[model samples]
Every structure is written in C-alpha cells, then in structure tokens.
Target: MTVQPTEPTTPRLEWFKSSYSTGNGGECVEVAAAPTHVHIRDSKWPSGPMLTLGPGAWASFVGLIAD
Candidate 1:
C-alpha cells in the first residue's frame, strides 16, 4: 500500500464508508476503487491524504484483516 496525494487533476472517485460505521461520528475510513488501484481516506476528511494500493495489495490486506 502507498500513500497518495490528491492532485488537482485527480478525477472524482466514488467513496464509501464501512457498513460497520454508525451515523454518529467515530473513527472510520472511506474507500474508493478503480480497476488498478484502491483508495482509502479518513471519513472525516475528504480532501486528506489517501492510501492507495494495487488490487493485489488490497486483496492481501483484506485477507489479513478480515474475519
């Protein structure tokens, strides 16, 4: 996984929060994905730095963390 900075020319991505997230403010993250990359950011900051990963990396991460 890599940290990616949002560029001025970066296209708008469809970001979604975790289903486990309640409506109330809490520690959470949002994700957006493209065919080649996955993006993750703090739910509280849309314009903040993002963690970008290749599809394989994302899958590996999910596998490691998922129950």
Candidate 2:
C-alpha cells in the first residue's frame, strides 16, 4: 500500500531549509513542524507533495540519521 503525502489546507506552512544548503541550487529539503507531525518537501519544489511524519516517527528517523 502506498501512503500518499498529506497536503495542508488553509494556513500556509512555514518551511525552513537546512543551513547547509548552498546558494548553488544543490539538493536540499525543507521542513515544517506542526503540533503532531512534521512536513517535509523538496526545497526546489515548494508546491510539490510533502511527506508527513508523526512526532515519534520523525524523532526516530532523525536519531537514526544522526548516528
């Protein structure tokens, strides 16, 4: 089963890109943190689909990647 990304409606999301992102248009991602979930999308495609993860799942993913 494919889990489609949820798109936000109404209020605009405040996305923040990594400080490591260079001005040369390199690969980058942006994230918006909500109360229950975190939204992730490509920095170059602000209007594109976003991957939403619950707080627990997002924290676990971050922990793994930080290792």
Candidate 3:
C-alpha cells in the first residue's frame, strides 16, 4: 500500500481588516474567505503566516465569540 499526502493549493485572497480596527496602535486582524476556507492574519503583518479554517469551523468559532 502506498500513502500520499494531499496539500491544498494557495488561493489568491482578498483580505480585509476588521471594521472594529482603528488607526491607533492596537492588536488587530485581517480575514479573507475562499469557497471552502477562511484565512486570518495579523493586521500589522499582511505578509505573515495565516491561519486557515473551514467554513463550518469558522462559523462555530464566530458563534462562540459573538456577544
């Protein structure tokens, strides 16, 4: 038996910073959405590493954080 690992291709994403973010120096994040995943990165570091989550997982995470 042979095993192969499948890697997801990087998609061109249009990222936007959180609306709550102000120009002042503060911790903020940016988000981009693809058909099957959501990407998150630090607002201050646009070219930094990103965190990816599936649609369902993203929804669940948002639900947990919503007020």
Candidate 4:
C-alpha cells in the first residue's frame, strides 16, 4: 500500500471503527462514509492521513473481503 501525505489542515470528521477491531487497538481501521467517496484512516491515529476511494471501488473491495 502507498502512503499519502497527511492533510493536517482539513476539517474534523466523525470516524467509525470496524466491528472487527479489538478494544486493545490492534490492526484497526476506521472509515468515514461520505456522499462522494469513502475516507479511511487508522483508528489508532484519528488525526493521521486518510486514503480516499470511490464508492464503487470501496464496495467492490468490501465485497471481495466479505467473500
């Protein structure tokens, strides 16, 4: 996976951690659902950089993982 630059100047966003995430915070990823795109970030660092993906791409990725 490629790491992108963190846009620290962006506005605040409400992040939702996956149900699969552990309370101890191991390999946790949070997703912020938006109208146009999906914003993903590490639950351990809410202020960190986010990877934005298109809705269709995100749905396909999730479907593959679900299977």
**CA-lDDT, candidates in order:** 0.90, 0.88, 0.89, 0.86
Q: Model 3, residue 59: what's the lDDT?
A: 95
Residue 53, candidate 3: alpha-carbon lDDT = 99
Model 4 reaches what TM-score against the true structure?
A: 0.75
Candidate number with the higher lDDT (1 or 3):
1
Report clash pairs, candidate 3.
none
- lDDT of the structure predicted as candidate 4: 0.86
Ranking of models by lDDT: 1, 3, 2, 4
Residue 45, candidate 3: C-alpha displacement in angstroms:
0.9
Q: Clashes in model 2: which pairs?
A: none
Residue 36, candidate 3: alpha-carbon lDDT: 88
CA lDDT of 54 in candidate 3?
97
Query: What is the lDDT for 26 in model 1?
Result: 84
Sequence-dependent TM-score of model 2 = 0.78
Model 2 lDDT, residue 31, Cα: 90
For every candidate in turn, the CA RMSD to the true structure comes to 9.0, 8.9, 6.8, 9.4
lDDT of 3 at 56: 93
Clashes of each: 0, 0, 0, 0
- What is the Cα-based TM-score of model 1? 0.78
* Candidate numbers sorted by TM-score from highest down: 1, 2, 3, 4
Tell me each candidate's TM-score.
0.78, 0.78, 0.77, 0.75
| Worst 10-residue lDDT window, candidate 3 | 6-15
Write down the TM-score for model 3: 0.77
For candidate 2, the 10 contiguous residues with the lowest summed lDDT are 5-14
